[model samples]
Target: MKVIKSNGEIEDFRADKLINSLIRSGASIEEAQEITNIIQLKITKPTPTRTIYRLAKNLLKRTNISSSMKYSLKKAMMRLGPSGYPFERFFAKIMQAYGFETEVDIVEEGRCINHEIDVLAFNKNTVVSVECKYHSSAFRASDAKVAMYVYSRFKDLEDKLKKKYHKKRYEGWLVTNTRLTIDAIKFSRCYSFKAMGWRYPEDGGLEKLIEKKKLYPITVLSIKQDSLQKLLKHELVMATDIIRISNEFLENLGLNQRKINQLKKQARALLG
Candidate 1:
């Protein structure tokens, strides 16, 4: 059977890929294989990836709620944006975990004109100017066009950025929630900048980084969407951050004891 990606591309369904994804999301090998079998049986037609995602998530939830939450990471990233602003701040927090001093929504003067940079990250050795390409839908991708445009802006700001930060090295990073086009990756390599997306760069994509840091978002939790929004509004974005907050703080957000308890349980299970 064929599978329809969010971008409308169709390809033959591969059971091994499905199994691997499940295993990566914390499913046991046996569980992943079993789930893949069930998924294959369910694929009677050219299935949309979202349909497969929903089915897989529901099955994983039935098997193990925490694993299901981990599987929800990609979709949860999509939930982080309609506005890219919040995603910029969220990504800055991700960089902080990487030992960088970070700031979001920076307005910097370029050689040509002023520009509002999405994120500015600096360490003792390097200063990175990041353009956050957040998309609400999985259909959108960061292409060569975006890479070119961001690099142009980076070029315009490079001198001022380097002068202000006084770092030994400078980098321009294009960070997006979705996948980057192959051309974009090629463009980045040729330009010596960094490009990161959902599952590029083999060993260390955004998803891998999040898993390594246990930076899973609140959207990955099995909570009401409204409550998710409430948490996001209060900057309670990371599942890993639940360790730092008191129950009283959650109560202040109008979450009841039962929901709070479930939230805590889910967060702990996810961390494991």
Candidate 2:
């Protein structure tokens, strides 16, 4: 269920949990299951996510997929905990990189309820909301339930905001790691709901970015058992260290400030 890192730090992970992560990352049920099976059958290492990264790289090459999808897939594989907050933050960053003014882990209030939208963005007359998943398969009933709940709430809020602030109606984006459920995908396409992970460019700009090494995907398993135990027993092992490491990697690779900030926010949220 759990795996160790190269530094001998232990972290607990369950197969079911990984399945959920995969679903959140936008994988289909079948894809998530297959990836889970492969990990269980072939991974005997301190860092299974690392193995997952290699496997995914091979998949991208063979499938000729886009870098954007690959990025999301790698994130699902390396996710350390149950909360989908990290991936939400990643979506926040990608939006910023694409030129939206963004907020991570936003709390929106309307009609006497406090709604926590994963990401919120604004650009001139446009306001947008995003919900992120890092799953390995298609969305489930629960996913639809939550999405409908939030979207319905925001629907009212959108009207209120438009009337009060004279701003444009808000756009809702459901960004998942894997693909959407059939119904969800249908709803998105018909209703202006934006989905990620479809279509590899024929020229494949995203694929080329990945293949040329402009974008590097690093997969990290949780801390090892002994290290986790020590930390639980009062020894210190700050997960924020991963933030520092990720920052170094991004900066070294010349990731834009927007991207760095997004990753930094995710690291802080996860470590805290």
Q: Name the best candidate (by lDDT).
A: 1
lDDT of 2 by residue, 184-258 (tens): 655555655554432222243222323332222222223344433332232122233335454555455455567
Query: What's the residue-level lDDT of 182 in candidate 2?
Result: 60
TM-score of each: 0.90, 0.48
lDDT tens string, model 1, 174-250?
A: 99999899899999999988999998888989999888888887778776777767777777778866656888988
Full-model lDDT for every candidate: 0.86, 0.51
The segments of candidate 1 whose C-alpha lies over 4 angstroms from its true place after superposition are 1-12, 40-49
What clash count does candidate 1 reach? 0
Instruction: For model 2, state the Cα shift of residue 184 in Å.
Output: 0.8
